[model samples]
Target chain A: MNTHRPWKLSVAGWAALLLFAPATVLAHQEIGQITGFASGFLHPISGFDHVLAMVAVGLWGAVLGSPAIWVLPVAFPVTMAFGGLMGLLGVPLPGIEIGIAASAIVLGIMVLAQLRPPLWAAAILVAFFAIFHGYAHGKELPEGASALLYSFGFVVATGLLHLVGILLGEAHRWAVGRQAVRAAGGGVALAGLFFLWQAVAA
Target chain B: MRRAVGTTLVALAAIVVASPAHAHLVETGFGAFYDGIAHFAVSLADMLIVIALALFAGLRGTRAARHAMFALPAAWLVGGALGALWPTASIWPVSTTLSLALTGALVALDAKLSDASVTAFVIVAGALYGFVNGATMTPGGAGGLALLGAVCAIFFVNTILAAEVTVLPVGWPRIAVRVAGSWIAATGMLMLGWLARPTLA
Candidate 1:
């Protein structure tokens, strides 16, 4: 896949960027950290494991129906927040990557198999997995990323990911759509297996 | 060839290791007034606290909403005046975030708060929050204009949000309000995480 650019071209590109770099220096880079909405929003959605798990949350909630529909959306973020808090405190919760990957596998199966647990039980299960995600993200949250807009974007993005799952779960309205939703679960499970393999291997 | 590789490697290394975050005074391209507005706008806890207060009031019905509309801005103004006069300890990142979480949780529950209770909550919260805001803006000490701008902004935002929530229909719209509250609640907790995180420096 001839993806590599010629060295000369790369060097020239570097030179061009370097030339404009001084302009950025004059644009208030020294005052303080500039907060980003896109980056925060992207953090959760950017990784495959996180996306699959978060979406699975919505899918499971939709399939479970009732209070969970709204409750799961709320629970995951708040629970994940505690997980993030734990990570910030450097409180060790081992197997973070494995747990995240496992969450996808388990949640995907919940949708694929249409498992229905009690509300409290489901919340606890989901909350347990949420800690893994929160810890991984919290540890990686970076130094200057501390601001409200960033947090807002991050939280909103998580809610949106759940929304995607719920919308897809709406397919359960019909038999064919139910099959489609189950197929999505199977697909998520498959992807999760790949991630699990990588985590274990790592 | 080696020179080019080294240069590329250096640039890549620079990009990878760069940390571009700190808390410092920034210009908002408008003036102190706009600076105040932007400051409030950019703040997560402050914005969440106001939204939670408004949503809590709105969910409690019109009387509560009305009281908050009047009480919040006025209390904030008075507190801001005192803050500008004498700066006090900053309780923002912690106290404000605590308020954000609690008030947000209240909104999410759509709790049936008494009108008097709602009014009292808004007044004390507003004054405390406004004092912190005013103290922060006093770095410029430009005749309290920025603080006034922030206060005006607080008033407009509170009124508009509370008004809209007050009029929401009974079903999905109300559910959406609750969802929004939960999001705010989650954001507050996450903000606390950020606050507690160690900086690179």
Candidate 2:
């Protein structure tokens, strides 16, 4: 395994950058203390469950390879904008909290299933779920933040995570690595299952 | 397993650190204004439809089946434009509920439609949602933006769930999907219950 590959280093470096970036630097101050971008970025990354689920999206995309690899990540942000609009229009989504938690469980399972859907199918599937993801982000956009910028920031971050998964997926060309990634997917699915149970019981 | 464990641990750590930031906005005794905006912004109809679509998609294993899914954003666009054009009252629960219910029912049937049929369905559905959103205006300064954010959050969350469904094997996937549907149904029921609760005399 060539650890010195530039592409690999670039991805690793980027992940490290995001991980080490100061919360204050990422924080948006547009609306009061919370800019829409800051809030959106924080919203997904803040919750442990959300963090796992989102990263899993990238991982699964990587496993599926190619088009799905790209489409799913793109689908989330584009549809999310639409969902945000619905939120703006006063269209409420019932069971938001539970829905949010379910996202983790559902996407996690998808990774474990390793279903390789076509590009178009992947787009549609991801888009459908994007509405839920977008609605959640729209609902929480702080009062004073700039909605456009907020949405943009989160979308960018989301894409990066997807890219991370793609890199990792590519690494799975090796048998040992593939098993490792699959195992990772299964683990994520299990965590989602736990969250689903907790949500249901509560 | 080690990698999974590591990822999970990191995720948990992140959540613990960010927990304090999840505080709800304080009400500041501005109930009349906030409540009005809240009602207008939280469309029960859209939420219901979204939940239904998510459930249907998860169960059927066909995300492309529901072309009416496009209606949601189209409605939002029209609603936003209307709000900009004519600012009025902050609440429109009746119109909201009706539009969402119609959309949900239509989308439920969408799985049966051809591509062209699905497109037509989405157009009609979007218009209805748009019309309802556009006609209703919140009295306060609050516009459709807030509601849009709320709904986006919900959709995003559901998307994550739908993705998970794809990962699960057929045998056990149904159980998870059913659980999700039940969760959505329960949430809808709870909201309805809250709405129908007897108002203070």
Chain A TM-score per candidate? 0.82, 0.73
Clashes of 2: 56
Predicted candidate 2 versus true structure: per-residue lDDT over A1-202, tens digit per residue: 7544665455455555455544434221224324544664566566666667667777877888755665566555545556655555557687655666677666766776777767787667666665676666555655444433444455555555655766776666788887877777788778877776777788
Q: Candidates' lDDT values, in order?
A: 0.81, 0.53
- Our model 1 lands, by Cα RMSD against the true structure, at 10.4
Residue pairs with colliding backbones in model 1 are A33-B22, A148-B44
Runs with alpha carbons beyond 4 Å of true place in candidate 2: A1-36, B1-201
Q: lDDT per residue, candidate 1, A1-202, as tens digits?
A: 4444577577768765654443233333323234556667888998989999999999999899888888888889888878887887788888998999899999999999999999999999998999999889888885555466677778889999999999999888899999998988988888889989999999
DockQ of each: 0.28, 0.02
Weakest 10 consecutive residues, lDDT, candidate 2 chain B? B192-201
Docking class of 1: acceptable
How large is the i-RMS for each model, in angstroms? Answer: 10.3, 16.8
TM-score of chain B of each: 0.77, 0.45
